[model samples]
Target: MEINDLTPAEQQVWRAFATGAAVDFREEDDEDTAEGAQWGPERTVRATVLRALLLNGPQEPGEIAAVKLAGARITGVLDVRYGTSDFAIRLSHCHFDEVPLLYGARFRQLNLSNSVLPGLTAATLRVEGVLRLTDCRIRGPVRLGGAHIAGAIFMDRAELSAPDETVLELNHVTIGDDLWAPGLRAEGEVRLNGAEVAGSIRLNDARLDRPGRVVLDAETLTVHGDVLMRKVRTRGWIGLRGAHIGGCLELSYARLSNPGDAALRASSSSIGELWLRKGPPMEGDLNLRRAQIEVLVLEPEMLPTRVFLSDLAYTSLTPHVPAEHRLPMLERDGDGYVPYAYEQLATSYRRVGDDHAARMVQLAKQRRLRTTRAWYGRLWGYVQDATVGYGFRPLRAAVWLLSLLAIGSIAYALHHPHPLKASEAPHFNPVFYTLDLLLPVISFGQEEAFAPDGWYQYLAYALIITGWILATTVVTGVTRTVSRQ
Candidate 1:
């Protein structure tokens, strides 16, 4: 890397590398323009010159050595694989002829803000400081798998377009700080599987467009801080299965669509707080099965046509509304007749001291349970529901008992029965006779001593059968209530 072989622009960049000075090549009015403009001799630097300076640069006394070039067309491959550099590389507003290959390389910091490139391949690379790609327009994949970044990676307003393939891959990476990538537009999958982020991953207003496929897959990703995706728009599945987020996962105002498939799947994940309200109805199913969330904030209208909530455990619910408003979502659970789902909602209601609402949830659970039972079991369930509300409505049982008592007493009062034993009969009172016939286990001497003939005898038989049904249903309801407690 002799200085005599360098172009005039390359010689100028070399002189400023040791002092960390930026070489601006664009005119004042064309500051916002790209590297496509034709420039003569002064605005072009070969990638070999930049790579050589990065590998071995002059040490300045108490001054940091950095390669900071702006608005220049970088030609050739800046291959630095398996190389180690202590200098910071800042190449803003530059256009690269080929993707810069930094695989398995270790550097202090790399900032390529407002640059246009075919792609970037920095897999297994280690950055001691931040990796900035803000406002970059990349046409190929940006692979960062197995990388370790000590500081944040900023990709604000960056556009990474690699259709039907992965645009950004950060799997198994360890980031010491946040992944701040707001306003990012990616045309393919953006994965962060098995990655551990010590700080939050903010992707607010980002649009990930990969229809009918998974656009964002962060499965098993562990984030120590919140994952905010407010106002974001995604056209495919966003999976977070087995992920653990120590703070809130807010997806408010996000429009997610992966019709007939799962729009968001967070199964087996553990999140501190999950918010899904204030958004339009999602087109696909929402699966939260086996997920444990501390505080779940959701609106009924936000629920999709199918939702899998089996075994989902949440300590609290937002809005603190009554059970009726929340019961509709349980009805939409794709895993039908999950008793735990209903019980979890009832438990959440009981925690807030809303016992009435809790009872309603329990009643709804029995009704849902009826749908999964056999014919005989369903028949019995219907009887119990109509009579006592499966013990959730104790007043309904009392009403049934009083109604039967009045019906039997009035029917027998209109017709008297002959005495079976004239000497043993105490009186001919219709109310006492009806009570003796209706009470299944108790007798008041009237039913044993008297005998009804013809139509009166049929009425007595009907009363006896109705009395047994009432007694059995009451006992069954009481037993169920005790067993649940």
Candidate 2:
């Protein structure tokens, strides 16, 4: 690290580090900032010299001291593990021969924008300011697990590729500000599991292509602000299971396709709001089982072929439509006949003052329950549904009562039954007699005083049985309705 051993570019960078002057090494016509024509020894700087300059840079009295170099070919590994630096490091439009090792290092800010590197291993790295990787192309994985950043991390327009391995790993990372990575193209998995971000996670317009695998696994990640992934196109799974978001989780216009499996799994997550509208029908399953959201903004047509919505609760639904229209979405639940999902939908409808639609959802829930019941139970359910729609359609009960009354009156009026005793018998009234026959509990003494012959007796027996069944079913339906309320 002697002054005499410094290369031409290194000598310029070393002298300029005290005053925080940026050393540009690019030709005038070089348009490609990342990897232009190869620079000779004149533009090459040893990583050891850069590391030494960063750690032991002379402080200027009134000027900021920083290492700012551009378009240089860094020769060796920039190993600054466990090192502490008071100055910032900005290496733009450069190429690194080896991955920079910044493990457990502390810095004010780190900017590697428009640089082409093999990889980066900065686990447990502590940065007081922003970490910029904008427009860079990384050929290998970038690991930042357990890192603490006071400022935001920007990876806008960056292309990270690791093929079958993870491209970006941010597990257990704590960010004081946002992690902005819009227009990112990652060829492998991007994990953010157990990461806690004080600000939002913006990955809008990103393309994540890891076919038949997990493209993004952000399980148990906690975000204080929104996690905006609008228009993100992913070829594999994007999981956010058990994640807690303080603000909205917007996935509007996203196209996620992972056939025969869950394309987006947000089960057990809690979010302020979830916007999944303005997208095409997803190619795979959308699992939101047990997720809690304040507001759910979804387009019904955007639902995938299969969905798992058991116990998923949302206080409000956008587009404020009838529950009947939303009921079809519940029907697509992978776990068939989830009563909680139906109840949640019904509650959402009721919140919107759509009581009729809420009742319809409840009715649908009952019908779905029938499918899971025993044969006898289903038969009884059919009876209730046919008579009164399980208390949801009270008009059906009135219609049934009127129809039965007419049939009974017509049958008895055709032929009067003989009286058991002449003294006890009243005048022959068909309507009163039919009423007595239909009303199993309250009788007008007609059924007790008279006895019918042959077919007439059988008809009377049938009426009595039908009357008792209708009474029992009506009571049951009414009890169910009252208990739910």
Candidate 3:
């Protein structure tokens, strides 16, 4: 394109680039600094730089380095859709009246650091090099859906606001390297659903505030490296449901404040490790239903009262959390008890060499099952709990037996039953008589010798029945322990 063919605004930008007099916005502190800097006749480069670059091929390296359109007010849409370019477009410290549309555009690199834009719509855009927007302030939503970046997306210290809806959408995007956005402040949801990142997604020290809504929705996202969000403060939920993270998902020191709903939902997601320890107490449920995590580093006290852990499997739990602290976290669905929830907890306890804790978890499972059982089953479950602690506390059976013996002996002594054959009987001892009545298989000849009529006879029968129940419970508990070992 000739200089005469260029529009007036385009010619101004072309002259700036050709003469190497283009203002470097990066060196200037802000838009005011760029406006104050004297650059020949024009203080501001009022041109669509994207159009100028497409019309005239890639500029020289030295010229491109100094080709910053600082304090420029771009008039029309900078549409680079379906076009191919080999230039590193740097538009720092510029003010855009409209957002740069890069839909389906291919670029070598794109840098808009420290710029102020209405928003960005770069759906299906492909970049061969880094896409830097660090420290930029975007007032509207940023749509990067279906983008394929061979390098990182740097938005460190950026302030983005798109209230109520998604502020930054990176759905189905592929990033070769890290998405570095530390210290970012986003007012609305940041959706990364179905995105694939070869490196970590570092949002450390970022503040995502969308109360009562999802602040970070990364469902089905695949990250080869970690998702480091250490010290992040989110007012709403963080959904990582179905995400496959090769490395740890570290949310340490995070402050999440959505009490009515799940603050973190990672259901069916597979991750190497999950670190939630040393954080502010979570205000809402941390739903990890069916998530397969290798290692879970969480402090018991840091978790909220309501945590959905159904089918949530983990090989290790850090900080040595006791089963007592973890059992309450497996919330029941209505009145129905989740047996696998207890099983998972028991497995966790067993992994930590807490056999006693494992047994306690089993006891809790049986207790919960009792609540959902029929009347007869519930009665039997209660009996098992009281007699032997649902086969967990075998010593309880002995305690019950001793108490029954003492009561029976006291009753027999107080009644003072006469012997059937007073002269022929060997002795009339209440202790022996109670023992004879209590022992089902062993006959001490005291029951036949004694003649307890009316209420005492019925009491004797009750003692016999009690003895059988205790004996059966103790035997069943012993068998169960042996089988478990």
Candidate 4:
């Protein structure tokens, strides 16, 4: 695009470019522009300047004067429609009258840092290089849906405000590198639903204000690297449901406050590790239902009141959280008493060689099953729980046996009886007789000689049943332990 063929606004931009004159359109004078002779004549660039620059492709950095269209009220839409250009466009400290529409446009690199714009609609847009919007203030929503970027999207220190909807929508977008937006302040949801990122999504120190709503919705997202949110604060929900993160999902030092609702919902997500230790206490539930994480780093005291862990699997629960604290988290599943939740915890304990903790979790699972079982099954379950702690605690059987022995011995001592045969020698020791009745395989001369009448016979039968139950429970518990090993 020649200068003569260009529009008036485009001609002025070309003149600045040809003369290497720095254009100034900012309302306020800064230190760099304090000297009037240092800057070129002030000119407000229209959208045509952007069009002419793109049409005339590939300018080296500083080849043209550093165009300062800051606070320039560019009228009409700066549409960069279906075309491929290798130019690196830098429109820093600029104010747009409308959103720059770049639907299906391809660029080598783009930088609009320290600018004030309505928003961006860059759907299906492709950028071969970095797209920097650092320190920019956006009033409306940014739609990067279905966009593909070969480089990073840097929005550090940016203030984005889009109420009642997604402030930064990157749904189904593919980013080759990191989306580094540290110190970002978003007034609404920042969604990356179904997006693919080859590198990390670093939102460290970012503040999202959307209470009770999803502040960061990255459902079904696939990140090759970590989702680093260290020291980030959000008033709303953070949904990573079905996201597959290759590196650790680090939320260390992050403050999430969404009471009653889920503060972080990673249901069905697969993470390399989940770090929630040494952080600000999460106010709401951390729902990890069906999530598969290799390592879960948590501080027990930092956990919220309710945590949904239904079918949530982890290889290790690090720093070895105690069973007392860990068990309570499993108990808060929405679907009460999820057996898989217990199983997952048991597996984690077993991995750490905490067999006792693993057994405790299994025992809790069996007890939970009893609550949902039929009446007859429930009766059996109760018996199992009481006798040997659902085949996990063998010591309970010994306690029951000792109690039964004492009861039977007391009953027999009160009423000593003679032998059934009158000729038989009276070897009527009540303790020996009680022991004889209690031990199924053992027989003492006292039992043979003495014959009890009335309720004593019923007492003998009760002792016999109790003895059998204790023996059976001990055998079952031992077998289960051996089989597990």
Best first by TM-score, ranked: 1, 2, 3, 4
Give residue 175's lDDT in candidate 2 (0 to 100): 96
The segments of candidate 3 whose C-alpha lies over 4 angstroms from its true place after superposition are 1-22, 25-41, 46-50, 58-71, 331-336, 406-436, 442-456
lDDT of each: 0.90, 0.90, 0.81, 0.81
Which tens-of-lDDT digit does each residue in 225-318 have in candidate 4? 9988889999999999999999989888889999988999999999999999777678998898889999889887678888888778888888
- Decoy 1 TM-score against native: 0.96
Model 1: residues with Cα > 4 Å off, grouped in runs:
29-40
lDDT of candidate 2?
0.90
lDDT of 2 by residue, 76-122 (tens): 89999999998989999888988999999999999999999999999
Off by over 4 Å in 2: 28-30, 34-37
- The worst-scoring run of ten residues by lDDT in candidate 3 lies at 33-42
Pairs in steric clash, model 4: 70-93
Give lDDT for model 3: 0.81
TM-score of each: 0.96, 0.95, 0.86, 0.86
lDDT of 1 at 173: 94
Model 1: how far is 242 from its true place, Å? 1.1
lDDT for each residue of candidate 1 in 1-485, tens digit (9 for 90 to 100): 88889889999999999888889886763564354445556788888888889999776898888999888888889899999999999998888888999999999999999988889999999999999999999999999999999999999999999987889999999999999999999999999999999999999999999999999999999999999999999999999999999999999998999998999999999999999989999989999999999999998878899999988999998878878899999999888888999999999888888999989999999999998899999998999899888888878877876787788778778877888878777788888888887778888788888888998889889888877877788888799778867
Cα RMSDs, all models: 1.6, 1.8, 3.8, 4.3
Q: Each model's number of backbone clashes?
A: 0, 0, 0, 1
